[model samples]
Target: MTITTAPAGVSLRGVGRAFGDHVVLRDIDLDIAPGEVVALLGASGCGKSTLLRMVGGLDTATSGTVRVDGHDVTGIDPRCAVVFQEPRLLPWRTLAGNVALGLPRDLPRNQRDSESRQWLGEVELQGFADHRPRQVSGGMAQRTALARALARKPGVLLLDEPFAALDALTRLRMQDLVEDVQRRSGTTVILVTHDVDEALKLADRVVLLGGAPTGVSVVLDVPGDRPRDHHQPELAALRSELLAGLGVPRRTPLERETHAR
Candidate 1:
């Protein structure tokens, strides 16, 4: 059984961020539908994570407003949960103990165990609940983190490069895990990733952030379905567009020359 929450929609209006003399983002406005998956893609330091943090109430925008479920975010909003790049699990705690930490404080004591077990099972970690963080692989640790977040029954899940630390194969597995869990739970998700194929594989729409001007953003609606084939010919054009926006070449110099001719 999946632990589900009434997924919440996220809204950003005229959002901008700046340090004393430098601006990182400006005039950014976007809306994410409830239970939808959106990926924020760009080169490093493009404010993708910053924008996600704002939505989760982890950071404040210098201008404009951010709302979740139509309520303005003023603090660490309870409606959202985050799974960061690192698993960030406590070394001393057993996997179950760590996941239990995310359970609602008001939940009846009798239901906590079942709740914890259900979420751990969601991430395919039912067999490792008794193990400490020190005993598991990096991918296992990250799966624990994901379970913890989901146990919160968050309306929106914020993912900040959650698979960046895993090996390529492990990363792919985690992506599938996340996609499966999100589909089951029906929570809105905002993923901040630098990987173009990852973005294309999972997102309903991909938003590219940053440019020469910095913080200039573009949104592309990705066709096809979730858990899409990475090499789908339809997505090739979209990949080229995203790479161009990030100022990355999609082909070798010779390939580019050949195409030009």
Candidate 2:
């Protein structure tokens, strides 16, 4: 639980990504401090996940720079680890075995198993380490995925809508689990999400990407600390602003009544 690994900062300067002539992102610039949590929110097809992929070196930028911890990302970055929308676990591996696969290869086999079990405990999946992916609930499997990512002790952790498929209550619980784990591990996080409230509740800053070839349209600093109440007055106001930025303006009281009629 006490992580000595130092977190890494991120810098993107004039970053752009294009698939041949069809550009998805261009001239994007943003900086994320180490140990910070940033959530990317935008309309569908706004290149939110593309931007996240660039950070993790899962995709390359067509032009400009993508740097994590002051080094350019040329390929799959060793400094980064990603957890995707689905659990994507190996069906045959036990939960601990799946997590142990990410352990540093230099570690002795006994240490690897011990470390993997520790991470599972960190994610509150302590006793479920022996369960296979199909034997656990969706949220439990997702927690195992998180444990696997954390077991790598990555400097930057990339999450691409990792909680998107869950029911409301499970989603909230997962968010809380992520906040707790990030706080303890001091890992930098970049989260790609479609839910505005989820972004506001979890991130230190919510980066809103939009435009024809998606750029940083708005960078709203979320007030308060982690584990925030999304319904707070300021968050409500910021939520409305973020919604409008995504082209989904909130309905006025009069409009709501009219629509109900």
Candidate 3:
């Protein structure tokens, strides 16, 4: 199989979407450079997932263009894949089968399993390949889904809170795994999440969406080193900024004063 770098990142011009009368996203323009990791950060109902859906071609933009690798995604691309909050794997299929399902049908059986095994190894789950989804833990299932997406060698990987359901420890491990995989694969990634800390830790740029018909509010450049400490001072500050941008209220002066004494 051939792997091509995503063309000129992903460019969005006047991208907008709505469901009947509910306008989810307003005029938005953004550019994600090739091999860049961008996080779409916002509170519930702020349309972060809507934007991701549009970018993924799972949903159409009510207005404007959604382009990936310089090609308009009027429909899903075989080269771009998504992993949602749920593992969404077939219960009847083994982990290896699920991963190999993404491979082109023309590939010989050996080549397909070889690709799946390599991706599973990347996530440290090579031994679980023959297990069914129910036989694995939530974290393991999520890892399988991630591996399935990676096995295809997609130019873009759209993740909508892929680790949200995992335990805190597992979530951190998955975050580290994603960082490592993206570094090695150079896959352009767009992750959508409500967790400020998650966004700060995973993305090169964190974009905050705000207001009734949500639109881009603040775009923060996360320049901290990769595999960054989630407890780092700079990340803490960035998290605070992101929380504020989402209109999350801060403590009152009275509370501050009381604590100060």
Q: How many residue pairs clash in each candidate?
A: 0, 0, 0
Largest TM-score belongs to which candidate? 2
The best-first sequence of candidates by lDDT reads 2, 1, 3
lDDT of 3 by residue, 156-209 (tens): 898988988999999988999999888878899999998888888888999888
CA RMSD of all predictions? 2.2, 2.5, 2.9
lDDT of each: 0.89, 0.91, 0.85
Q: Per-residue alpha-carbon lDDT of model 1 for 1-261, expressed as tens digits?
A: 657789999999998888776888888889999999999998888788888899989999999999999999998989999999999998888898888888989888778877887789988888988899999999999999999999889999999999998999999999999999888889999999999999999999999888643564689999998889878878888888898888886864446779999
Off by over 4 Å in 2: 251-261
C-alpha RMSD in Å of predicted model 3 compared with the true structure: 2.9
lDDT for model 3 comes to 0.85
Q: Per-residue error at 20 for model 2, in Å?
A: 1.5
Q: Is candidate 1 or candidate 3 better by lDDT?
A: 1
TM-score of each candidate? 0.94, 0.95, 0.92
